[model samples]
Target: MKTSLIKLTLPLAAAGLLAACAGGPQPPDWQLEAKGSMDRSVAAYMEGNSRVEMAELERARTQLTRSGRADLLATAELLHCATRVASLVVDEPCTGFEKLRPDATEAQRAYADYLQGKVQPQGIPLLPESQRAAAAGNAGALQGIADPLSKLVAAGVMLQTGKASPEVITQAIDTSSAQGWRRPLLAWLGVQLRRAEQGGDTQAADRLRRRIELTQGISAAARPLTPVTKP
Candidate 1:
């Protein structure tokens, strides 16, 4: 039930693609088979699609939301996958961030494996390489790895899915900082965290406070850039 905060602010997939999911209603399958197909389709659609019909995408979104699958990912991940589909379409060679997603489910694992197998011609589910994952592995673990996304996804899927404990979110922000990926995303997460706290999650608020502290540290290390280029 992990959802990435990336889903709420960004399209997850590039704008054109997810909207394309807006087609006529899809055929039904046994719940298991259908869930699998939907997941694959979402991944595939993300691999190579530019435009998505909003209506179709919304329908697909509904389908996923209502599905009875376990370890079901957050809507944000679907959107993220949709963007990947668009990317694969644009640059099939781009296996950019696939490796960072180790927790992605089996078929998703297969797809990553397939991409690597093309080179080795081997069959085990090999993970796509991502410097980000390496970095995460090296850094101190972050507690709330999927706080924003997971909680949101759960809230949508189940009635009692509560906001992440602030402590958890704070740890994730700290981890993200220690590993990089900070930038504006961290700043944004900060605001959202604050709002979330005011909405009755003081823990989320505290994390946001720590995030602000981390961002300040990062800002200090950065040097102002001049237009001049080194020869």
Candidate 2:
């Protein structure tokens, strides 16, 4: 996915691109570095590379700090939080972004609200192209998003908003699976597993359990090996 993809959700992630568009000069090195780190961070997180995600995110944050732009840093933090939400890790608020929200742009604030499922009708147009449809209560528009990650994030936002349908869940699962995004694939599978158990569909529950286990195994195997230390 392009680094600019996140800009669809919020204006902060593409500070470099915005600068370049305003004139003919290339973006400063700091902006390019920050944007690249931010892009890699999200991609790493989606692929379940927790170590790389945190490292890249910190690198982005450091670069943004060097630019003395609190709002840009806030945007980076919000993007991290939003990525977590997309993977179904919804237990936390975007405290990091909130701390610096005063410096954020109106569009950035709107996106923060949208991710929390509290976005107003006026803010619909400010959201990412994929999320705008869901924010407007038009879940059907999710189908029109060509990017799998974008579609999954929109569906995840729908879940947070209590507007998710069975089809939305299935679509999220299929999208994550297609992208080999193990983090979200496992998360959506867990959702299905819970529903199967609650509905007393023993067969379906068992299948989901096995699938989850298999996915977990793949994730474990894919992790970088740690060298053994001599005792």
Q: Residues 74-146, candidate 1: write the lDDT tens digits.
A: 3334434333321122133323235334555544444333322222223222322221121123232222224
Residue 171 displacement in candidate 2 (angstroms): 1.0
Count the clashes in each prediction. 21, 0
Q: Please give, for residues 49-95, the per-residue lDDT of candidate 2 as tens digits.
A: 88899999999889889878776787788778878767887767898
Residue pairs of candidate 2 with colliding backbone atoms: none
The TM-score measured for candidate 2 stands at 0.85
Q: Which lDDT value does model 2 have at 66?
A: 87
Q: Candidate 1: global Cα-lDDT? A: 0.34
Error in Å for residue 31 of model 2: 1.7
Angstrom error at residue 226, model 2: 21
